[model samples]
Target: MSPRKKIVQAAFEKKKLNGVVARVGLVLDISGSMRNLYLNGTVQEVVERILAVASKFDDNQTLDVWIYDNEFSRLPSVKENGIENYVAKQILNNETLHKFGRNNEPLVMEDVIRKYTKEEPSTQPAFIVFINDGGVVKPTKKVIVESSTLPIFWQFVGIGNSDFELLRKLDEMEGRFVDNANFFHLDDISAISDENLYDHLLHEFPEWLQAVKSKGLVL
Candidate 1:
């Protein structure tokens, strides 16, 4: 098996996310600053790793992929095999990061809220893997506070050497009804071990499950 596939399988066997999260959303950042990461295949690798993680959560073994810079667009649902090609096409497409403009992390969360509450509500708790490499600036604090009662968790992963000020703030942010977000720093994510990666990736999830259940966020 490929190293990526092995990581995925190992996560399923050791982590045992089965019956935990009912859905997985892999949110990718396509800002200009993120261009290198996407081009260098770091983002694709992360997608593959997350796809592996998602497989353990959802029965369909697929992930709802969303890309954003200042704006958000939901691409097609992707499985492990198609991740590389799917990302390649997006990166090599006419709409380059320069055209996409700023990196608005809040817009992605806004889309997530609209999708779940109005567009399609699911009682099953969702695990959102939000990837970015810089600071956030979208008044996401209010969004997280409002969505605190909803059945979803945001696991923010920071890539590259950029200063993730907003992510750090979010990690330490308070006043929410429940703790629904966690952050992980991956300066060079490609070099990280799958075991260590998965460990931190899923560290706070069980507590989130208990918290959400106590609040009746998921059924």
Candidate 2:
């Protein structure tokens, strides 16, 4: 019922999403910098809004949720029921300092790529929403470039006032099979219009989907 939630749901409804091959994934940055966002409830609202979008994807309306700093840990999927309490508890109860001060995206990506490929091995492309405060390392760029050929689209949403220098560079850094990564530096996430935010969030995904399919990356 919040504006952000309305925007996410409306944007999803506006898209011709039927038959779109997608598996939803939400990656939350639990770094020390993100602690304030968690305390102030922005992260919870974000999870709920994204969960609203994820529900449209499958019968269970569930999304894979992961929290990462230098490493990553998979949490219970965000389902349609009790989502708010579920998300809040996950953030509130966790050790915020778990491998603190590091945002090794490559480690997380490797885990996701390996787990999904071996366990599921489906052709459905994954839409990974990576929430962070702009701590992408050099190896992340290499891993991203290497993984561009895989069936996954990475949308990096930068929260807070950080410059997101590396993320911006990654956005313009090219020569992949297709543009698999998109970046947004949000000055005030709560103030953003849902329409605009969702537009940015979903914009590059459809194109990437087509490109991957055409290249025989997604069968």
RMSD each, Å: 2.4, 2.6
* C-alpha lDDT score of every prediction, in listed order: 0.78, 0.77
Please list the residue runs of candidate 1 whose C-alpha ends up more than 4 Å from where it truly belongs after superposition.
1-16, 94-100
Candidate 2 lDDT over 1-219, as tens digits, reads 755556666676677555565788888887777777778888877787677667666456788888888878888787867676665677567655263456778887787777567777777888889988866777888878888888888999998787678788865787787889888878777787667777888877877878888999887
Clashing pairs in 2: none
Report the C-alpha displacement of residue 98, candidate 2, in angstroms. Answer: 1.9
Best by lDDT: 1
Model 2, residue 216: C-alpha shift (Å): 1.9
Task: Return the lDDT, model 1, position 81.
Answer: 66
**For candidate 1, what is the TM-score?**
0.88
lDDT, residue 115, model 2? 58
